[model samples]
Target chain A: MKLEFSGGVLTAFIDGEIDHHTAPSIRETIDKTILQDKPDVLRLDYSGVTFMDSSGIGLIMGRYKLISSCSGKIEVINIPRNMAKVVKLSGIERLGRITIKED
Target chain B: MKAINTMKLEIESRSVNESFARVAVASFISQLDPTIEELGDIRTAVSEAVTNSIVHGYKEGKGKIYITVSIFENAKVTIKIRDKGCGIENIEEAMQPLFTTMGGERSGLGFAVMESFMDKVKVNSVVGKGTSVTLEKKINGRFVTKW
Candidate 1:
């Protein structure tokens, strides 16, 4: 996971399969960045992610809570079709808008 | 109803093995020439089941998770994930969407995902005994003759 921050916006570039084994670390990193950077917007880039399950949903929900508490916004970009289904099924759009980049 | 092919695997109830289990199942079922969407659904469903065993059943403790997959002649696949760890007290409640006992760390969508992805999902559990989740899906007509 790589994070870039600029102009009150933090973009997280996450790669690999986001599952139970990796979600904790990802959550920790995002939380730490949100705390230190205090970015007004959190953009999650999921183009490189090969797989994801409910654990990924939890990660996003947890981050939404943290970012929303600070009155910040969250956006998910470049979600693959398969993952977008999971995200939509989990009703994550209620928390933030998910943008799918054309491949 | 005899299965045309069957495979069974037993692995430690560890988080790291979740991906391995899913990928293994997907590879095995690739013989049926499932579409990309169907394969993804099966992998996602298997991932949820194995994750439930590791997180809820084993609670990060040591245990064994058994995954049994069988492909029928009709192109229907059945996957059973069993764990000899702490089982749920109420199977009905556990199957509910967003009902997690792990506080906020979990999304409580394991069973929900399985139900959505698979045609049928059956959860059988006895507290202090163990839990087994059975998921079944029928692959639509998309057989790859190359295999």
Candidate 2:
């Protein structure tokens, strides 16, 4: 995962697969960035993500809580077509809008 | 369904091995010529069950995860994943969505996702023994030739 913060927006470019084993590190990195940078918007970019399970959902939900706790909103963007079903199934829209970046 | 082809995999319960286990099983079943949707669903389901073994089951310890992938005729498949870790005391509560034993780190959606993607998901466990998750999927995909 890669992190970039500009204009108070912290965007994480998630790559590869996300599962229970890999989610913690991604979560930790994002959380640490959120605290240190205190970005106004947390944007989780999934353009490079090839696969995900429910563990991905957990990562998003956890970040939602963390960001919202500190008054920051989260936006999940650029989801691959294949991974969109699981994302929708997780009901993450409550956290915010989920936009799929078109190729 | 009668299993015409079968393969067994045993891997150490390490976080790093999670992707290996799922991809291995997915590759094993790919001979059935599953559609992309079918393949993706299987990969996601396999990842969940194996991760459950590593996380909630083993819980920060080392163990072994046993996986059995069986390919039946007519593009149907079944995967059985087992682990000798601490078992769940309550299967019902555990299956509920967003009910994580690990709190915020986990989404508590493993079983639920398996149930969604697969045709059938059966979970059996003994408190002190281990847990076995069996996921079944019938591929209604395009025509295929079996190798």
Candidate 3:
């Protein structure tokens, strides 16, 4: 997964599967960006993502914790519905807008 | 109603390459108009399962993890993940929330996350053979086909 930071949005365009192995890097990348850039909106665009598991869940929850402390908002766009069901059940709908795009 | 289809992929238990997979699966399944919370739930659940296979099953060694998915006639989705590593001794105890046999850097929320996301989750393991997990969810009102 590659993370790009610009202006008030810290965007991460993740690819491949997100599990425990990938969470640390993702967390580090986003954390560094969030701390350094301190963006108002942390956008995670999942246009390239393919697979994910619960550790990926932990990643988002952890990010939510970090951004919440700084009063920053997190938005996840272009999420697939299968993953969307998992995210919605986690009660993260209150955190950001989850949109499904046609491919 | 259109006939449902199935998709399957086998991936290395490496964490570096899963982000793209997670995003792709999430984006593909988003036709159901899932909420952000639901997306997070699915990602977290998948993460836990894959991570468990990597850390616990393979112990960071090289191994193959099979992830198979199926979509039912009603747009229901099911994923089957399997690992041929050190299997579980007891499935019942393992499924308990906050149970961690690893005892390091883990909160033991894996099974909990999986059960929370998919409509149904089934796990089967043998002490010396392997482990398999099946996750299911219903995707309603989507017209897209399998990719």
Share of real interface contacts recovered by each model?
0.82, 0.84, 0.37
lDDT of each: 0.90, 0.89, 0.70
lDDT score at residue B82, model 3, on the 0-100 scale: 88
Query: How high is the TM-score of chain B in model 2?
Result: 0.95
RMSD of 2: 1.5
Model 3 spans with C-alpha error above 4 angstroms:
A1-19, A22-103, B1-3, B28-37, B141-147
- By summed lDDT, the worst window of 10 consecutive residues in model 2 chain A runs over A94-103
Residues B84-106 of candidate 3: C-alpha lDDT, one tens digit per residue: 98988889989887677765335
Give the number of the best model, judged by TM-score.
Answer: 1
What's the CA RMSD for each of the models? Answer: 1.6, 1.5, 7.5
Number of backbone-clashing residue pairs for each candidate, in the order shown: 0, 0, 60
Residue A22 C-alpha lDDT in model 1: 91
Candidate 1 lDDT over residue span A1-103, tens digit each:
8999999999999999999999999989999999999999999999989999988889888898899999999998898877877887898888887776686
Ranking by lDDT: 1, 2, 3
Instruction: Flag the better candidate by TM-score, 2 or 3.
Output: 2
Higher-DockQ candidate of 1 and 2: 1
Model 3: per-residue Cα lDDT over A13-100, one tens digit each: 8776666766677778888888988888888887776655555556666777788788998887876655655455456566677565
- Weakest 10 consecutive residues of candidate 3 chain B by summed lDDT: B138-147
